[model samples]
Target: MDILDQLGAVREGKLSRRKFTKGLLAAGVAMTTVPLPARRAMASEGEQATYFTWGGYDIPELFGPYQEQNGTLPNFAIFGGSEEALTKMRGGFVVDVSHPCNQSMPRWVQTGLFQPIDTARVANWGDVIPELVDLPGNGAEAGKVWMAPFDWGQTSITYRTDLVELEGEESWDILWDPRYAGRLGSLASGGDAWWCGAIKAGIDFANIDTPEAFDKIAAVMREQRPLMRLYTDDTTTLEQALSAGEMVASMTWNSSAVLLQAEGIPVKFARPKEGALTWVCGVMIHKDAPNLDRAYDVIDSLLSVETGHFMINDWGYGHSNSKAFDQFEEETLAGLGLSKNPVEILNAGHFQQPQTQEWETQMNELFEQIKAGF
Candidate 1:
C-alpha cells in the first residue's frame, strides 16, 4: 500500500506493527537497540555558554529579553545542518542548547551529549501541548527533554497556483512528472532532499533502509534532477524563482508559502498525497552546558505565549504552544494551514527523528553521488 493508505489505516486504528515494521526498518529504527544519552552537567553560570542553533532562531530579538531576565547572554553559533550541530557537539563545543529535531534527539541522547531538562524550572511547561511535550523519546523525568519543540511546520509543494491547476491537489508525484521536466526546483541538502525523494519514490519514508528502497529514491531523484533548474538550500532563491516565473513550483517550508501568499504571490502550499514531511526545531541542552539556570530561562522564554505569538505571526511557523492558536483569527488560521483540526493534522503529519551517524553518512554519500550526476 502507498503511504497515504498506510496513514489512513493508522488513523482508522488498523495500522499494526506487522504492517508498519518494514517501513519502520527502512526508516532505520531498531526498536530493541534504541540508544539513550548519558547524563552530565557542564559548569554553572559564572562561565559562558555557547548556543548552536539555526541562524534566525537565536536572533537578538528572541534572546535579548531572556538575557535581561537571566543576567547573562548565551554566546551563539549557527549551523545549516543537524549533522553539523552533532559534529560540533561531539567535538567539545560547549553549547548550552543545540537546536535539533525530534529525529536527531535519539542520536544525540545516545551520544551522551545532552543534559536532561528540569521541567520544573520551566514555568510554562504545562502550556506546551501534551503530546508535543511528552512525545515518545522526550525523557522528561531524566532531566533531558531531549529537545523542546520551539516551532513546527510542514514540508509541502510550494507552487504558483496561478500558473498551474491540478485536478485534485498538488502531490509528491508531481516532482517526478516528466511533463514538467526541466522546470522544477529541489533542495540541495540531505534531510529535505532525502525526505522529498523518499516520498516521491513511493517507499514509505519511515521505512528506507533496504538497498532497493535507497535505489528507488536515487532513481527518482536522478530523473527529477535533470528537470530541476537548480538544487538549492536557500529559500530566498526559491521565492525569487517563484516570483519571477523562473520556476512555478518547489518543495519548501510552510513559512515560505505563507510569506508569498501574504505578498499576493498566488502560491499554494499543498499537503502532498504522501503526507507532508513535518519537522519541529527544539532546544537540546548540551550535557556540559554552562549557565544551566540561564539556559532554563531561555527555554522558558521561548515557550512563553508571547514568544509563541511572535513565532506564529512573524516567523510564520506554528508554535509549540497550543495557546498560540487561540490568538489567531479563524481566517488567519486557515491561511496558515492551521485551520485543519489539530488532531487530524498531527495524525497525518510525518514527524522526523534525528538519524544515526551511520544513516547520516549514507545520506551524505548518496546525496553527493546524486549531485555528481551518478
Candidate 2:
C-alpha cells in the first residue's frame, strides 16, 4: 500500500490493527476542529501556523515569548520523525510550517510539498549560521529556502552512567555490547537505526547509496535486535526506562540525555571514536502557505536570541543561529552537551544522509525484521 494510503487509513481507521498499534509506537498526532472565531482570530492577529515537530520543540515555555510578541501562538503539532510528518502533510493535512531533519530535505523538496522561504520577509535570516543556512548547498537556487534552521546535534549513546563503563572514546560498538542484552531500548522505526548502523560500518553518510553499505548495515541491525527492550519513539518513555534501569543504555538523540540530566537521571551522552551521527531539524513552509507574512513572523521569533536560549537549555539541542549561544552563560551552554570548540566537536560527528528510495525500502524491511525479534 502507498505511504499516503497508510496515513489515510490511519485517519479513517481502516488499516490492520497491528499496523495501527505499531504506528502509535511511531508519531503522536494532535489535531482538533477549530471554531470560526478561532480561525478568524488567527487571520486578524497572526497566521495560526501548525508546526509538526518533535515533542520538546513545541513546548509552551519555548513559544510563550514569541506569542507575547506576536499575540498568537503558532498552532502546534508534534511527531516522532520527518517521514511520518511528510506522510501526514501529503495525506491532506494542511500546516503552514513543519520541522524536518536534514536527511529528509532532498525528498521533501523533490516532492514539492514545501515552498522555499522568501528570505526578505524573515528578519533574522542574517543571524543563521552560514553552514546551516546553506545545508543543501546554494539553497537560494532551489526557488525557495527549503529550511530555516533551528536545532542541530549528534546521535550518540545515552547510557546509565552507573551501569556502563567505557575504556576508550564512545563508539557504535556499545549498542551491541552483550552484557546489557534484553535491557536495551532502541527506536523501533524511522531513519535513526540506518544512521547508527552506517557509523558502525564507517560508511560515508553523504554517499551511502551502494549495495555494499546496505549489506554491512543490515548485519549490524540484526546483531543488535535481541538486545533491545522496546522499539520506542517516545523520548519521555525512553528516558523513564533509562531512569528505572530498565535499559542500561541505547542509541538516542542528544536531547534525551539533556532532559535526563535536567530531571536528575544518572545518564551520560557520549561522542564515540568512530564519530557520532549528526542530524539537523529545521522549520519548513508549505508551498501554499495561507499566511506567508505571519509564517515569517513565527520563524523570526523562533530564531530570536531569547527563544534560542530556551531551545538550547530546555529543548536540549544546539541552535542554528551562532548568536543563540551568546544568549547563554558559559556554564548554561555547557549544559546542552555542546563543546565551545565547534570544529573539534564536529570532527567526531557524521550527518544522516538522504537515502535513495530503494535504500529506504530495504532499510524499512530490515527495521521491521529486527523489531519482530529476528
Best by TM-score: 2
**If scored against the real structure, what TM-score would every candidate get?**
0.80, 0.82
Question: Which residue runs of candidate 1 sit more than 4 Å off their true CA positions?
Answer: 1-49, 67-74, 140-144, 165-167, 179-182, 339-342, 353-355
Model 2 RMSD in angstroms: 9.1
Model 2: pairs clashing at backbone N, Cα or C within 3 Å: 116-144, 117-145, 170-272
Q: CA lDDT of each candidate?
A: 0.69, 0.69
Local lDDT at 288 for model 1:
79
Write one digit per residue (lDDT tens) for candidate 2, span 1-374.
64455556544424432243233323332111211111122323234666667655544445655577666556666777677787888898777788887778878887777887877777778878766776653285645577888777877789988888776876677788898898787765648877778788778876577778878877887888877787777765676677667788877887778766766768888768788877776788988777676677668877877777766776567777678787667786666667444444455578676665567667777667767866
The per-prediction tally of clashing pairs is 17, 3
